[model samples]
Each structure stands twice: as C-alpha cells, then as structure tokens.
Target: MSTEPVLPRVRPEIAALPPYRQGRAASADGFKLSSNENPFEPLPGVVEAVRDEVALNRYPDATAGQLRAALAVRYGVTADDVLVGAGSVSLIAAFLQAAAGPGDEVVYAWRSFEAYPSLTLVAGATSVQVPNRPDGRHDLPAMAAAVTDRTRCIVLCTPNNPTGPIITRAEFEEFLAAVPADVLVILDEAYAEFVTDPEAVDGLGQRVFASHPNVVVLRTFSKAYGLAALRIGYAIGDARVLDAARATLIPLSVTAQAEHAALASLARDAEVRIRVAELVERRDRLVAGLRDAGWDVPDSQSNFVWLPTTDPAVATAFEDAGLMVRPFPDGVRISVGEATSIAPLIDVAKSTILR
Candidate 1:
C-alpha cells in the first residue's frame, strides 16, 4: 500500500482560489499608503461610545435594527429596505448566495475589487469578467452584453478599487437600461464619501430605488468612517430582495460595538465630510504632481491614485522611498495618505518618471 496521507475532498474551485491579498504593511519608519484607508482617527466619542455600549456577555442584535433605521432615515428608505452585515464584502456574498448557485453565472468588471472572484467562487457561481476600459473605468456595454440566461447577478464598483476611476451617473442609467430588469445588480460604493466628482454615480438616492427594483447599493463604514477594524457595512435595496439576502446572512455577525461606533460616526457627519474633503484635496494635489512630472495618471475620483506601469521596478522604487503601495500586474495603486506622505510620494513619482 502507498504511504501517502489521505486528504479530505475539497471543491476544485475552492482549492484553486487564492487567498485575498491585503495591502502590505509598512515598517515603523515607513508610510503605509497601500490600503485605501481613512488616515484620520475615529470621530469624537466613537471609541468611548463603543466601550460603554458593548455587552460582551450577550449576543448582538441579529438584525442591527437601530442602525438600519438610522440609515433608512438618512437615505429616505424604510427600515425593511436596509440590510447590515459584517462588511460590504459579506453583503456581496450574501446577495450572491441569495441569487446564484452552482452552474449560474455572475458578471462584473475585471480588475475591480480583489474580493469579487473569491466571493463568486465561494457562492458556487461562474464569473464573467468584463474588462475595464483604458482609462480604468468599467466597460458597461461589454458587461451588459456578457449577460446570459445563466447570469444571475452583476456588480458595479464605483470609483473602482485599486484603479480609482468612477462610473458617471448618466452612464450608469444607460447601463441599467441595457441590463435585464430581472438580473440583480449591485452598486458597490465603499469609497462614496471620498468622491468629489459631481458626475459620479450615487446609488443612495430614492430615484434609483424607485426606478430599479432589482438594484442593490452597498456602502461601508470601513473606508470613510475609519471603521475597518469593526467590519460593519450595510445594503439598500428592495425589501423582498433584501429579505432573500437576510435569509443568507450569517447570524449575528454584526457586533454591538460596530453598530454603536457606526451610529456615533453618523452623528458627526460634518466632521466626516471635513476629513473626506481634506483627503480629496490631497489626492488632487498628488495626481497633479504626478501628471506634471510626465506620468500618465488616470482621472482618479476616489481616495487613491493609480500609476499605469507593468514594470515591477517602479513599485520597488516606492518601497525604497519608504512608501508601501499596492501593485497589481498592470499598475500600482497608491492611497492618499498623510499630508507628510504626499511630498515623498510625488518625489518618488518624479524620480521614477521616464523622459
């Protein structure tokens, strides 16, 4: 008999899926500009509120009722229309599970969110990745064309992660027109607070809900509210569709601490906007500096900028300059970090630019 150890059977797709890659952490003296995170500390009282309100001995509210009601009021929706989860990624996974199964197909833009592939695979659905345009925006027409009878869901990431370009409101309306009404469409807007472009699509308005019953909007406290550690996010959509997603939700995953922090953050919306405005200004300055230095940077409306280069040396150059940036196969994504980090980042760009 062979002496090889027996292994439990695992689904081939699950076995083959690579783990999600987090942005690289930097050394003590280095600036961590890899993760597109809000550089500011939490809003005043958020930490104190979480500390005071959390009941560690008891389970959290399974529905996150108060948070949902607050979000609904802000967005002019009913409480039933809001669904909370551990993160927007969890909401995506829940909606995918609700709408798709083995042999079904899910559609989204390529080079968008890194988690999309893993989420789809975990839901046992086939992925149809439509390529992004040269400017790093979604090719909505191609994505609409990719829909087939097996297609069950579609994801649209505005100011798409890692690349930082946005889908315009008009373009999104047209894209929605092209997509079948029955196919579920998710608008992932994790960086919505950082967006300064007036033309960028916003899925929070009531008009989108009134017109598109099949559409779902995902928002997170991670990026703007500086609540990444809490891992709380929510979705806005039709009650029936949200009901299906709720059915698929992992019970009580949204902790009481996260909910309290979100409420506290929401209470200080003005402060959040101020912080976001500062980041937007920093991003614009960084982009302008890179362009003036002869780098062909794309129009980034998010909290990060993308440098289109296939050369690994460029990323290494950033590392050498004490800045950690996220590098993809085709380019590198640098988050808008501290005011202090901007000069060094631009200096690196200037030095790395080819004549």
Candidate 2:
C-alpha cells in the first residue's frame, strides 16, 4: 500500500485534554442565562458601525491599532500599554502560551472561568486549581501557595465567572503581595463593567503596580459594552509582557468589523456606563428576590448570582422552568439580564424555592 506520510500525533498535553463544553444556544423557551452574555443589543452607533465595516477584500489590521488607541483613551493609559485581540478567550490562550511551558504549572481558582484549565493545558502547562472558599471566592492564600519553582502563571478572575464574587481591592493587594514575583498573574475582569464596588480596583490599575510586575489585566467588550458578537478584548501589562503575548497571537486575529465596533463602543462609552448602572440594579434585585426565597444566593457585583445547590435536581428544575442557567457541580450560575428579562427567573425562584 502506498503510504501518504502520517502526520505526527497531537501533543500529549492537548491529546489528553477534554474540550470546553459551552451552554446551549437554543432552549425550549424563555431566556438563556447560561453564557453570561449581555442580554441587550449593541447600541445604535455600534450596530451601525459594524454594519458599515464590511471589508472582505482586505486583511484586518494585525495589531488592531485603532481599537487599541480608543481603548487606551477610555482606560486612561497609553496605546503602547494596550493589546487587542479577537476576544478575551483568544487573549487568554495567548497569555498562557507566552507564560507557560510543558511541565510548568499555571494556577487559578476552581469554578472560575471555565476556559482557564482548557487553555492552560493546551499551552503545555499543568493546571493547578485552588479551591473556592465557602463564599465562592478564590482562596487567595491557597492560590499563592500553589506556586512553586515550576509555576509560570496565575489567573485571578474577579467578579469571577459562575460565582459572581469580586476580590476587594485590599484582598487583591494582599494576594499580589503573597504571589511570587516571577509567576505572571492574569486578572481576568471580563465582567468588570457590571461591578459597582466603590473601592474596587480596576484591573488595569493593578497592572501599573511596580510590585506586581507580572500582573496582566484582561477585559472584554462582550459583557457591558453589549458587543459579544464582535468578539474584541484588551489586555494591559508591562510592555515586554505584552510583546511576548503579542508574539503568541496568530496573524490577523481580531476582525476588522469587530475593531470598528469596539472603537465605536469606546466613543459611546458613557452611555454604556449608564447601561452598566442599570444592570447593576437588576443584579441587586435578582439577588434580593432569590435570597428572600430561602436560597443562599451570593451577593453578586457581576451580572449573575450563584445559588448553592445540594442536588443536581435543583439545577434541572431551573431548566424545566423555561430558563437556562449554567449548572456547575456545586451550584447554578444565573445571569441577570434586562429588568424585564429577569422577571421569569424571579418567578421561577418564587414558585420552586419559596413554595
């Protein structure tokens, strides 16, 4: 038999890893709270900008220069400090690629961003998961202790995914103090906009701390800016760290239309900020209502709440009620949407939990 050369098998780390399973796009009825997407449409200007940005004949700008400039202005930093990519997920993969190597350990909290371990493993790093405390927040001390001579990076997801808890500025400063300076710590702030803590440390500001030279702050236009479909995000860190991170990106990663939409969102950021305030109100209401029904719903600064569940049956109950939520092993993460969108969730909670 004539042999076409067999491609060498996949990398061991990647070959053994399980895939990232995302939430269902279609459900029987009602709203889907699974993905934590902004349940609102893009603002008119952003929508119009995206519509007009069709350029199939040309390649997108590899570095996303225009969007990075706009993000810099919006975040009060120089453009050199900013790096834009296809989505925060893409940036996460690049950061892992830049920071880690085979047999190197990358630490992050369990039940945080679901993608963390997947990307960490795919980049040839060993995943070190720090368990969440009783309140569903990262155990900072434990995470810091997980670092060793072989540790390469750490991901701190504030307003953490699934569990909507933010590490206070004081807590983060302490966490930074505990972590080894050589281990790159990525602060994933994908839901930073929905957060309203008066003393909350913007992840970008933390990247500026000389003591935490390894800190990289990650944020996305998906949640609060209402631009999930456009898939643009930015990371802020030391210029050298950013340089290394950029090297990991494939050619033309961020789309041209996404860049235009991101720029427009930055231009209309004040309006988006106002929208964030409104969503915060809705989040508060959802937490209040759920807690009143005798369920232990964590105080959520993000656009979602975590309900402590003793059984998976309770998770299925939510799905049966024409509502979709992210069911983790220990609990369900229910996203707060538009004021009206949250009504059905409240109704289901009242019917099932209260009565």
Candidate 3:
C-alpha cells in the first residue's frame, strides 16, 4: 500500500480560511451593483489604447515604467516611490510576505475591510483587530494602543470599506504618534476618489518619504477609473519600502493592455472627476434616505453605504426584494451604482420599513 497520508497536509491558517466571496450578479438583466465598479464606461481614448497595446504580442514592462510615470505625475511623486501591482489587493499580499511571518502580529479595523484578517492569516501571522466605533469609523485610539513590538504592520483603510467612513487628519496623526516609529503603516486608499471629507488624512506615501520612513499608501484604478477588469493598482512609499515590495512581487504581473489603459486614464482626468462628483452626490442622497427610513446609516464617504442591521432578518428582507447586497454580521454594505441599479434595494427598504 502507498504510504501517503490520508489527509493532505496544509498550513492551519490557510485551511481555516473561508473562501473569498463577493456578492453575485442577480440575473441576466439584474443589476450588478455588488462590486464597487464605476458605473461609467471607459473613456474613448483608453479603450483605443488598450486595443493598440494588445497587438504587441509581448509581455508587459516588468517595471511598468510608463504607467508608473503617469501615476507619479498625478500623485506628485518621483518614479522611485511608486510600485505597481496586479491589483491594490496584490500589494497587500506582498506586504504580508515581505513584512510578516509566523508569530508576528498584524493589526487593522474590524469590519473595515473583510480582506484584512484573511490576508494576515494567509501570511502566517496573527490578526489583532480593533472594533470600529459606533459611527462605523475605525477606532484609531484603540488601534494605536493595541500595537506592540511583535506587531509587524497595521492597515488603515480610509473611506474604509464595508462601512463608508474616514479617519480624520487629527485622529490619524495621533495614531501615527502612538505607533512605534519602526512599525509599518499601510493606508489603503482604494476609495479615495469618492471621499469628500474636508479633514481627511492624505496618508503614508507623501509624508513618509520625507520623514516617518515606515508608511505606504495603496491606490487602485479599479473603482473611479472604470478599470475593474484591468486589475491594475499601485503603491507609493519611501524608496526603500517600495524596493522591498517590488522584491517580493512576481515579475510582469501587470499585462501590457492594463498598463496602456491606465496611462490613457491619466489623460482623461477631467471626465473621471465629473463622474466621481456624481457618485458623491448619489452616496450622500442614499445615506439621507436610509437614515430617514430609520436605518442607522453613517455619513458615507466611499462609493457605498453601511446599513447597520444587527437584526438577522434585515439581510433576508433585502434578498427578498431581489437585491443582492453584502450582508455582514454587523451590517449590510450597499454599493452605489447608477440610479436604476439600486432601485431593487430601495424597493425592499420602502416595502419593509414600517415608516
């Protein structure tokens, strides 16, 4: 008989993880507002550039030089400060591999981004999550207090996911002051474009390059850029930190077409701005609607709203209305799409909400 073990050996962390699940599309003609994709079509020039790039029959530039250059100009950073990845999500993985290991601790906000604890666990590290405040914002003071010498990094998601809230500049600066100088701080700004917070913190890259030395910012073209399918994202940080990120990344992860499309997007900034402005209006309107309906909705700064439904029946009611929103134990994250896309979700609230 073969001497192989009956069950396959696996890392306990990996084995323990529930697979990643995003809300599914409802039907052939049903709205796909589950994922936070931009409702607009790609800019004319961006589509043409992507088509032109596909004819090259070659791999993308390993360094993604042209895309990096465009991003640098947009962010007011030098080329050395930017590190492009397959997606902003990929950089999170690279950070885990480069910075954390067994017995090390990773910290982040609970219900901020569902991916945080999963990413930390996959890296053979322990996750230390501080709960979000009543308003769905990250609990900055508590998070800063939890950081210890064993802590490798803390991810600060602003205009935080799931719950659309931001970290105020004052709160963030205080959090930074409390954290050890050596501990890495990753500010994931995946939804930065939609944020209307006048007092928001700009995050790690711009300042760390000058002084703090252990901070990084992750941004993506997936949402406001209407490039979700392209899967391109970049990180900005101190040169040394960016170098470390690049070292651990797989070569040529970005496709040539994606690089071209991203570069094309830089030139279409004005149009994207108009579209983003529309989203902000819609988001604010949705928040007010939900709040008036007696659902405790926070002031949303991202492209979504959090319906804090501590009641188990709330999610089922949403589904009963033929709307597929992400239901968390703490709340439901309702993505904002075109007006028509969310009609079903609105219908549910109108019918079931006794008001």
Candidate 4:
C-alpha cells in the first residue's frame, strides 16, 4: 500500500481563490505607510481599559452587549439594531455569508476595497464589479444597471480604499432610489472620521436604515479610533438584518479588551476628535505638497492620498527612500504618517515626478 495519505476533498472555487494579502511591514528605520493606520499612540484611557480586563479564564461576552448599547446610543438606534464583529471586514464577511450563496450576485466597485471580491467568492456568490470612473469614483449608474434578479447585495465604499474620492450624498441617494428595495446595500464608511468635505455623504447622519430597510452602515474603530490591534467594528441597520449577520459571526470573536477599549475611546471622544483633526490637516498639507510638485493627485477626503500611476518603479523608489507605500496596478496609496517622514516623502515625489 502507498504510504502517502490522501488529502481531503476541497471545493474548486475555494482552492482557486487567492488568500487576502496585507500591506507589507517596514524595516526598523522606515516609515510604514502601506497600511492606512493611525500613526498616533492609543489614548491612555483606551490602554487602561484594556489592562482592566483581567479574566483570562473566562470567555468574553459573546454578544458584546455593553459596546453595542454604547454604539446604539451614539447612532440614535436601539441595541438590537447594532451588530459588533471582530472588525468591519468580518462584519462584511458575515453580511455576505448571510445574504449570498451559490449563483447569487454581489455588486461592488472595482479597485475599491481589495477584500470585496474574495468575500463574495468565499460566500459562494458571483461578483459583478463595475469599473470605477476615470477620477477613481464609483460609476453608480453603471453599478445600478449591473444589478439584476440574481443580485443579492451591493457594497458602497466611500472615501474608497486605495483611491480616495468619496461618493456624494446626492449620488448615493439617487443610486439607492435606482436599486431594488429587497437588495441589501452595505455602506462602508471606514474612513469617515477623516472626511472634511461638506459634500460627502455621512451615512450615520443620513439615517439610511430608517429610510431604507435594506441599507446597512458599517463603521470601524480600527482607523480613526486607533483600535486596529483590538479589531472591533460595528454595523447599524434593521434588527432583522443584523440578526442574520449575528448568526454568521464567529463565536466570542469580539474580546472583552476590545469592547472595553472602544468604550474608553468613546468616553474621551473630544480628545479623539482632536487627533483626527491633526491627521486631516497633515493629509491636506501632504496633498497640497504633492500637487505643487506637479503630481495630478486626487482630492482625498480620507487620511491618505492616491497617486494615479501604473508604474511599478514608483513604489521601489519610495522603498529606497525608507517610506513604504501601497502600490496597486492603477495607483499608489500613501498614508499621512509621521511629520518627520513628510520631508523625505516630498523629496521622493519631486524627484520621481520630475523624472
């Protein structure tokens, strides 16, 4: 008999799917801008809250009741309307799993979030990716046209990842009107705290859930709240919709430390706002500097700016200058990190663009 053991059968689609790739880590002396992370240290209160959770022997509150209640009050919703997950990405996965299955279609913008396609695939659903416009904004009309009877869900990422343009309130409203009432709409506002534009859509303020039973707004404490390490995010929508997502969630994924830290962060909301304001100022300055250097940078309402370059060499050049940025097939995304790193970044941009 052959000594080799047979491998278990695997689904072909799952086998073909590429694992999600994360941003590359930086060297000790380098600035890591590949991930759109908050450069500031965690608030003292947040740190203390995490330390206060000492029950290693006990499992965390699986429902995350305290955190959900807190977020419910903030968003003017009942606790039943909120769903907490390990992160916004996890909530997205749960939503996809809950709503989509084999032969169903999930529509979203291409070159938006890298995880969208994979999430759909994992849910045994088809992805209908509408191409982004020349300005890196979602072509909402095209997306609406793409939806069909097979479509189960639509993901709208504003201040879109990798490309920083936002969907205007008017645009989203019109798109929502065009979409069928039964189809689930996920409004991913991960970077909303950095937005300074008056015209941009605020999903929370818009009361999308109240207006449309199908709409769900996803937000994260990872970016602006500096809780990426803790991995806590929440969704606001109808109780029935959230209940479905809750069914698909990993048991006890949201830790007590994360929930307490999020609560602490909320308590010091004014201080958090100040940190966000500083980052926004830095982002604006960085965009201005790049534009002055003759780069055709987009007007980013997020914490990062996009460089519409297809050149692979640009990323290498940045790495050579001890700055790690995210390089995609269509563009490079450079986050506004430390103030000390800005001079080097600008110098590199000037040299590369001039070349």
Candidate 5:
C-alpha cells in the first residue's frame, strides 16, 4: 500500500462518461448494415484526387479555405459563413464548445443522435433531453418548452438518426418562431441528401439564418458522398457564429486529402445523386418488405429503416442470418446496404420475428 503510486485526478464527469463506440463489425460473409453508410465505393475521380494530395510532410491549410469556398459558393454563402472541420461530429463539438460551458444547458431530442449527450457533457453543459413522440419523431413543441434561460444551444437532427422521420417545414418554422432569438439552434441535416419528402425542412432553401441569424446548418460528406473515412464536414451560418466555432477547432484537423476528395466529389454532384437515388430506391423496398412482413416500421425518409421491436430474438435472428444491424433499447436500425442484403434481411424477419 505504501509503495502504490498516485495517479493524476480527472474530472468526475469525464471519468463517468463512457467512450463513444462505433457500430459493431460484421463477420467476413455478413452484410454490414449497422453503420448508416453509403453502400457504394468512392468515385474514381475522388480516389485520384485524394492520391494527388501526397505531400505528407507539409501541414494542411488549417482554415481549409479552398473547400470552404467551394461549399460557400454552392450554398450561396460567403466564405466567412462556412466553417469546415474533421467531420460533422467534430464541427458539432466545436460549435457546442464555442457556445456553452459549465452550468450552461444544451437542449436536444432524446433517442436522437447517440453523440448528443456525450458532446454536451464534454462541453461542460447540461443536456435537456426532450422525449421523442411515440411515432419516433422529435416533439418540437416539447423541446421548445424544455428550453430555459440556462439553455445556450439546441440541436435538431432532421430525418433523425436511427429513427428516420423528419421535421416538416411547417413544424420547423413554428418551432423556430417559438424559440428565443439568442439561443443557438443547430440544424443537423446529416442525411439530408436521402430525404424524398417534399415537406421536410430545407435549411438552405428556407435561408433560415438569413432571418433568424441564430440557426446554424450542419452537413457532411460522410453519409451520401462516401467521404466518411476522410472525416470532412462543414457548417453554414452567420459569419460571427461560424467564427466562434472556427476559433474552437483543433489546428489543421481537416487534412489536404479530405479537402481534395470532397472537392472532387462535389465536382461530380450528378453522379453522386445517381448513387443516392439507387440507395433511396433500395431503402423504400426494404421498408415495404418489412411492413409486409408485419413489422411496424416507421416511414423512413433516410438511408436506413427502423424496426420497432425490443425482442432480443429479432436481433439474434438478424445476426444469425449474417446481417449486422444496430439494436437500441426500443428498436433496431438496419441500413439499406447491397441490393442482395435486402432479400436475406426480409427473409430473417419472416422466418423469425414475423413468426
């Protein structure tokens, strides 16, 4: 006991926080559908572009000006209004750190993004989690009511992760009107490209920040553009707001390779959309098949479908069939993977869960 060494003290919150984990890996022959990832391979042009950025000896441009400019032009925003980071998650952390601190509060919907609670805690802020509706959509009015004077930021995940229903344009507009002007509203549209609903909120089309000025729209190349490995994403908001987030970023976190690849991907927007269309079609078929198999699947507008079942046997059935899916406390999220995966997934449901 006397010879025991003392370790450095860490914050209790930090000590208690469970580290973020990725989706479970699948077996060699299994179709990996746990992660809501683009099933397609990276475009040939994107691969070549990434390869061209081979000057590893040099530090990448910390500001990522080129990529920022490209994004700004596409969104009709100034370069100052755009801020790029390692990924949407990293950019979200930066924005949270910029606006919140000890004793402050961050408001978001529960059963939403897995990272929201961890991000809030890491930012030294309290998370005011509003429960989702029984239908699995965020209760927008309840979220607005949950806001207090202590709330510094609020995050809205459209076509919400895991559960794929989106906040409609009318719903969003009403919610925006109810929230205070000073509180930061983070519109996280990670799966925006997959949305087919005409009524879903379009942060860019509405020019939300133009009038509100408090809203920040976040998007990524990870989901639709298949640039997840590079971890590049960006935000669109007021210049001053984006500046705050920029200040909190780790230096040169966005690599040259990521920038080039994203730029190349953007140049082939038409081709990317074509791939996205294929995935969307697959998702619709999967949903229809699951519904026909007696699953109470939600009307998913994202690249994944939610199976509303807490039965362990359902998850076991999927695993046994060599298909990996993400199981939460209430349901499972199965990404629309290879076209071949659909038949096996539906077969498992019919053979086990539906029985």
Candidate 6:
C-alpha cells in the first residue's frame, strides 16, 4: 500500500483562492505606513468604555442594540435599518451571502478594495470587474454598462485603496439611475471621515437609504476613529435588506468591547474630526512634497497617498529606508503616519524618481 494518506474533499474554488494579503508589519526601528491606520492614540473615553466591558463570563449582545440605536440617531434612520458587524469586511461578506449564490454575478471596479474579489468568490458568485479609468478612479459609466440580468450586486469604493481618487456625487447619482432598481449597490466608504473634497460623494449625507432602498452604505470605525483593533463597522440601508444580511451574520461576532468603543468614539465626534483634520493636512504636505520631487502622486482625499508604480524595486527602496509601505501589482500605498515619517517618505520618493 502507498504510504501517502488520502485527503478529504474540498470546494475547488475555496482551495484555489489566494489568501488575503495584509500590509507587511515593520520592525522596531521602522515606521509602519503600510496599513492605512490612524497614527493617533485612541481617545481616553473610548479606552475607558472598552475597559468597562470586562464581564467575560457573559456573552455580548448578539444584536448590538445600543450601538445600532446610536448610529440610527446619527444617520436619521430607524434602528432596524442599521446592522453592525465585526468589521466592514464582515458586513461585506454578509451582504454578498445574502444576495448572491452559484450562477449569480457581482460587478465592481478593478484595483479598488483588495477584498472585493475574494468576497465575491466566497459567495459562489462570478466577479465582473470593470477596469479603473487611467486616473485610478472608477469608470462609472463602464460599470453601469456591465450590469446584466444575472448581476445581483455592485460595489463602489471611494478614495479607492492603493490609488486615491474619489467618485464625484453627480457621477454616482447618474450611475445609480442607470443601474437596475432590483439589484443591490453597496457604497464602501471606509475612509469617509477623512474625505475633504467638497464635491466627493457623501453616502451618509445623501440619505441614500431613504431615496434608494436597494443601496447600502458601509462605514467603519477602523480608519478615521482609530479602532482597527476593535473590529467594528456598521451599514445603513432598507430594513428588509438589512434583515437579510442579519440572518447571515455569525452570532455575537460584534463583541461588547467593540460596541462600547464605537459608542464612545461617536460621543466624541468633535475630537475625532480634529484628529482627522490634522491627518488631512499631513497627507496634503506629503503629496505636495512628492509632486515637487517629480513623482506622479494622485490627489489623495484619504489618510493615505498613492504612488503609481509597478516596480517592486521601488517598494523595496522604501522598506530599506525604514518606511513600511503597501505595494500592489500596479502601485504602492503609504499611509499618513507620524510627523517624523513624512521627511523620510518624501526622500524615498525623490530617490525612486531619480532612478
């Protein structure tokens, strides 16, 4: 008999799927600009609220009622219209599961959020990705045209990851009018709070939930609120649609600590806005410095800047200089981090351009 052991059956698609690649961690001496994390420390109130949820013996609220109520009030939606998940990523997965299955198709912009493709695949749905425009923004018209009868959903990411360009409000409204009212449209606004561009689409301010029952707006506490470790995010949409997503959620994945932290963060919105403004200024300075050094940096409205280059050598150059940056196949994304990291980042960009 052969010595090799037989393996159990597995879904071929799942087996072939590449694992999600996270930003590389930095060494003690290096600045971690790879992940788009807020550099500021957590607000004191948020920390205290998390600490207060120390009753480990009991399970957390499966529905996350208090947080949902708070978010509903802020958005002017009913509590039933809001759904909280472990993170925005989890909410994305839930939405996918609720709307898609085998033989269904999901459309989204290419070179957008890295997780979009994987989430679609996991739903046993086919992904129809429309390429980004030359400027790294979504070609809304092309995406709108790609939809077919089999298409179940569409994802739009603003201030797109790894390539920082936003979709304008007018463009979004026009695209929405073209898309089928029966299909779901998810606006992934993970970096919404950092946006300063006056014309950029504001999903929350638009009251899309009220106007378009088919649309869902996803927001997270990770980036702007400095709560990545807590893994909390929420969505606002039609109550029936959210109910479908809630049915697919992993029970109690939203922990008490995460919910408390989010509530506390919301309580100090003014303080959070101040911190976001500081980061915005820092991002502008960094972008200006890179442009002055002859690099083609995109206008970043998020807390990160995009360097359009496919060369791995460029990324290695930044890493070697004590700056950990995220490198995609077509570009690199460096987050606005500590004030000290700015000078070194600009230096690396200048050297890379010279090469």
What's model 1's TM-score?
A: 0.97
With candidate 4 superimposed using the best TM-score fit, by how many Å does residue 165's alpha carbon deviate from the native?
A: 1.0
Candidate 4 vs. true structure, TM-score? 0.98
Task: Estimate every model's Cα lDDT from 0 to 1.
Answer: 0.92, 0.82, 0.83, 0.92, 0.91, 0.92
Query: Of 4 and 6, which scores higher on TM-score?
Result: 6
Better of 1 and 2 by TM-score: 1
- lDDT string for model 5 (153-263, tens) is 999999998899999999999998998999999999999999999999989877888988999999999999998899999899999988899889999899999999999
Candidate 3 residue runs with Cα over 4 Å from true position: 1-8, 204-209, 342-344
Backbone collision count in every prediction? 0, 0, 0, 0, 1, 0
TM-score of each: 0.97, 0.93, 0.94, 0.98, 0.98, 0.98
In candidate 4, where is summed lDDT lowest over 10 consecutive residues?
48-57
- The sequence of per-residue lDDT tens digits that candidate 2 reaches over residues 1-355 is 9689877898776778788887755354567888888877887688788778858788989888887787777667778888998788899999899989888999999988888888987898888998999888889888888889998998888888888888888888888788778778888898888877777767775544345668888899999988887788889877778888899987797889889988888788678988888888888988988887777776677988998876777667778876778888888888876576677777777766743
Task: Give lDDT: candidate 3, residue 305.
Answer: 89
> Cα-based RMSD of the predictions, in order?
1.2, 2.6, 2.2, 1.2, 1.1, 0.9
User: Could you give me the TM-score of model 6 versus the true structure?
Assistant: 0.98
Off by over 4 Å in 5: 2-4
Model 5 root-mean-square deviation: 1.1
What TM-score number comes out for model 2? 0.93
lDDT of 1 at 117: 88
Q: Which pairs clash in model 3?
A: none
Of the candidates numbered 3 and 4, which has the greater TM-score value? 4
lDDT of 3 by residue, 113-155 (tens): 8888888888889999899999888998899889988999999
TM-score of 3: 0.94
Scored by Cα lDDT, where does model 6 land? Answer: 0.92
